[model samples]
Target: MSIEVGSKLQGKVTGITNFGAFVELPGGSTGLVHISEVADNYVKDINEFLTVGDEVEVKVLNVESDGKIGLSIRKAKEAPPQEREQRRPQKRSPRNQGNNRREQLSFEDKMNRFLKDSEERLASLKRNTESKRGGRNTKRG
Candidate 1:
């Protein structure tokens, strides 16, 4: 059977290398499974995930004009239910979770804090400028 991009097929691991694995497709045609396409997790060694003669379900990612077929084992597998659940919206507590059990700050308090921080930053910048100018003026004197 001719493999096309996006097609899924079962293949045997004919060869394995540091970079990728070669899979024998249904029509006896071979494809390369790039290291990046091996799995969702980091694959330090291809042998850890696959072995020669091992059967694997792979998705055809590309078919080059030179007859090089690129396959992906990661895309063929379905994501775990836990992963799907984690992606869903979660409920959060209304109360603030912190060591200080004080009530949430009001709009005015927030604005005051922001202003204070801005003033401190401006003051720090002014001090730096003054120090640099002070050195220059002293050198000229």
Candidate 2:
């Protein structure tokens, strides 16, 4: 059978690796389901969601000319729009977004803040280097 992109297929987990799991599709063809495509949330370990010999329905994401097939188990399982939206990260409110701080502060205030931070950083760097060079009182021959 020809494997087409976007087509859902039945596959069995053949192998598992740190990065992804290999699935054997119809016609004895194998494809890789990346760790990210295994589930909607973070997947630190692919073994947590799949195992060898497990039957799973996967969606064909891409079929490369080199015979590499990209598959996704999460995409195969359809979810309602509401659920999909819920899984997505929500946008932060304007008050919570700190990007507008520069716009809120005057130019003078920003300059003053920058000068203060720079001074503090310079002092810390000087102190660290002086200590590493056998202290400020040490004389070089």
Candidate 3:
């Protein structure tokens, strides 16, 4: 059967490499499931996830013009809506909120805030260093 993009197919793992796993699809076509596509989480080693002779369901990501097939095992498995929602980051605290606050601010406002914070930090650092210097400014014998 011809492989089509977005189609899920059951294939057997033919070979495992550091970068990816080669699966032998139907009609004898082989495809590479990259390490990054092996799972939703980080995969340090492909062997930890897949092995030769293991049957896995993979979604066809792309079929290159040169006959290379790109597949994803993670995408093939659909997660429940609730489970998917659980994986999403929750509302962040004001201090931990990353770029959301900065993105809403105007360029001038952001620059001013940055400058104020920087000046404060610099002043604090200077005070710390000056205090560490033993009797630098004191009347010495």
Candidate 4:
């Protein structure tokens, strides 16, 4: 009846909280399954997954010398199909992938485009900057 690290056990959930669920092990001690350990997905609420008196299979993650036990319900279950999806890399944006349309432009073409953009931005800045500071006071004293 000893609860060892890395062991799997069946337990009845005795209580539920925003942070986690408390389960009473067959060996007569209770442990917590933290919200993060309850599932592989983003669990915004632990109550959605477990309830008081619900039986769960949990893997013993650790047993501290001070007697605090760490458990994981997700670890005891087989690899879920969604696990593969999460493991696969997400689709990257085309901009990040180095397939930028600008890359197709020749060096001279790029320089020309840059010069044109710079001129336009500088012209806009010059027009707006003076207005933001206000025109000189032309009123006669």
Candidate 5:
């Protein structure tokens, strides 16, 4: 059978290589499915996904001028996207959670916290600036 772009067909894998696999289509025509096109996930090794004589469905991506056919297994049998669970759980802000929000801090406490943060930021900025300009102890005589 003649192969054309956008045609899907089942073919036997004739050979497997590091970069791709050669599939023999019906009527003895062979095409290559690149390693990256083998699956949706990262494929470090193509052998893990395909082997010689394994029949796989492939979509014809292109028909080159020199009779080379580029195929994609991932696109041929496109799997429905699986719902992925969130890796990181939603975090609750400490200030909005529990007793911290229930207890009202006095103005003095808020001012103290703000002052401490300001002092730390200023100290960090000074240290960063000083280090950039030949460091704290580098007063040249």
Candidate 6:
């Protein structure tokens, strides 16, 4: 059977490497599922997820010009119900979770912090400008 992009196919894991797994499709065609495409979460090792002779469902991502087909295992699996629920925005309490005893900063406190930061920045800029101007004063007698 001819495999096209977005086509789902059942394939056997023929080889496993650090980067990806090689799957043999029905038509004797081999495709590569890159490590990044192996799972929804971070996959540190490909072997942890797949082994030789294991049957897996994969989605054909692309068929390169050189006849190499790219497959994705993560894309083939349907999203879990919990994942769908988590995608929705969650309601949060107005109170801060950590440091319950610590009160929120007052407006004056915020203004003071901003002014202190601005003063330090201005001082640094003045120092840089003075250094640049001083460096230009070197002259031959």
Clashing pairs in 4: none
Worst 10 residues of 6 by lDDT: 94-103
Error of 4 at 74 (Å): 0.6
TM-score of each: 0.58, 0.58, 0.59, 0.56, 0.56, 0.58
lDDT string, candidate 2, 1-79, tens digits: 9999999999999999998999999999999999999999999988889999999999999999999999999999978
Q: Encode model 4's per-residue lDDT on 1-141: one tens digit a residue.
A: 789998899999999989999989987988889999999999999989998999899999998888788899999895667997898779978766786666888999999999999999998987777666674533334
lDDT of each: 0.89, 0.94, 0.92, 0.88, 0.89, 0.90
* Weakest ten-residue segment in model 5 by summed lDDT: 80-89
lDDT of 1 by residue, 1-141 (tens): 667898899999999999999999998899999999999999999999999999999999999999999999999885668997998768545643552343477779879989999999998998788778784434554
The weakest ten consecutive residues by lDDT in model 3 span 132-141
Q: For model 1, give the 10-residue run with minimal summed lDDT.
A: 94-103
Q: How many pairs of residues in model 5 come into backbone collision?
A: 0
Cα lDDT for residue 61, model 3?
A: 98
Count clashing pairs, candidate 3. 0
Error of 3 at 31 (Å): 0.3
Q: Order the candidates by lDDT, highest first.
A: 2, 3, 6, 5, 1, 4
Better of 3 and 5 by lDDT: 3
lDDT by residue (16-73, candidate 5, tens digit) is 9999999999889999999999999999999899989999999999999999999999
Candidate 6 TM-score versus the reference: 0.58
Tell me, what's the RMSD of every candidate? 9.5, 7.7, 7.6, 10.9, 12.4, 9.5
On a 0 to 100 scale, what is the lDDT of residue 58 in model 6?
98
Q: Name the lDDT value of residue 124 in candidate 2.
A: 96
What's model 5's TM-score? 0.56
Model 6 residue 59 distance off true place after TM-score fit, in angstroms: 0.3
Overall local distance difference test of candidate 3 = 0.92
